[model samples]
Target: MKKSRILLSTALIMVLSASSVYAHPGRTDSNGGHTCRTNCTERWGLEYGEYHYHNGGSSSSNSSSTSKSSNSSSSVKKSGQSAKEIATQKAKKAQQEKEAAVKKAKQIKQAEKDGYADGLKDGYNGISNIGISKYQGAYNKGYKEGFAKGKLKLTNEKNKAYRAGYSAAQNGKSSVVPSIYQTNKALSDSYLQGFERFVIDVEKQKYYQMGYNDSFNMEKYIKPDFDNANHIRWYKEGFDAGKKKQAA
Candidate 1:
């Protein structure tokens, strides 16, 4: 019985050894390249032509598979790199476009402010000059036509200034004033005085009509009768108030 047990133990040891070898089918060859172990191709059921072993234990088929795997890995890396570069370029381009849009908006707003400020100052100066030169005799029939034309001129200027102010405010550039507020205020004061005492009923109507046509936002004056001195004063006050408010 003891001899029979020893034989059974030897057979079990041989089975375990064969299993370990079969599980590990790879080994280094004489040429320092990887190859299948002896009898591995047959044990794994691989065809002889697909995994033929030479005397040096090298496998041509396995070497070709390793090369193909390496090439596939390299190609995947290259494709990933190209996609990343394209995404980076698109991000840069989008940023540049956003910056350009902001810059253009700023420039357009600045231009609008410049136009308004220049028109206000020039119009005020011209109106003041006309008041000094023409208001004394505007009641005469011969001078009435020229007086009407002069009011239209001043109305055009006021319209230009108000339109620009509105546009600048709308474009988010309201804080940047192209003209001096104090200068506008002082000019408005003089215009208010001239509008009160020198302007007659017909002239006031003409001015009010002109305001309704083009300068409604800048000047809102109603026609005043001879007895309503208070109404005339209100017209000047309204003009000054509108100017100061817009400039601010």
Candidate 2:
């Protein structure tokens, strides 16, 4: 009986050892054994039974796809930023060009104004001096009439006036009688009256007449020789005539 009991105990130990070894790779439960493979479908309610078998490959493929998606997003962002930068640069360039054009236009307008002012000044000077060759004949006639009679009248006042007129004619200055007159269409009647009564002597009367005629009447006389000895005299006459017309 003692030997049978010992044998029975040895058999029980062997069966327990075999069961422990099988249960080593899984957890024991009343239903069955639950391994990582069975737990995936039973506990987690996975529809696919091959989940654990292909878990590593599926995870690796998903990671690769995610990485590719991230890279594509980054590329699109970079491309969009580059396009925006290009557009911004073009807008800035266009604004600068527009400003430059406006500045150039302003400069051109200022230049035109300056040119017009200069032209007006030159025209006024030309009218006052009558040194322009086109009017030289009238200037000469006035000078001859005033200076010749001035020789006969030895009085201080007459001589002084004659000398002044001669000097003015030589220097291409405006006549004393009309002063530096502006070229306006309407003549001053008072100025003409003042001129007629200004000088009284017979010799002075001829001088006055010469000056008046030359001042009011611009002759068709054109000088052939600009460098002639009488060029200044002719220009003086024309200047007087032009000056007189302002009050004619």
Q: What does candidate 1's lDDT look like per residue over 1-248, in tens digits? A: 99999999999999887655535446534443333434545565433223322222324668776555444423211113477789999999999999999987666555544444444444544542222222233223223444445556666655555555445544545334345332454334433333332344445565444433432354544454536664455555545555555657
lDDT of 1 at 39: 57
* Best-performing candidate as measured by TM-score: 2
In angstroms, how far off is 37's CA in candidate 2? 44
Ten-residue region with minimum lDDT total, candidate 2: 49-58
TM-score for each predicted model, relative to the true structure: 0.24, 0.25
* Model 2 CA lDDT for position 130: 20
How many residue pairs clash per model?
0, 11
> In model 1, which regions exceed 4 Å deviation?
1-81, 127-248
- Candidate 2: stretches off by over 4 Å: 1-81, 127-248
What overall lDDT, based on C-alpha atoms, would model 1 receive against the true structure?
0.48
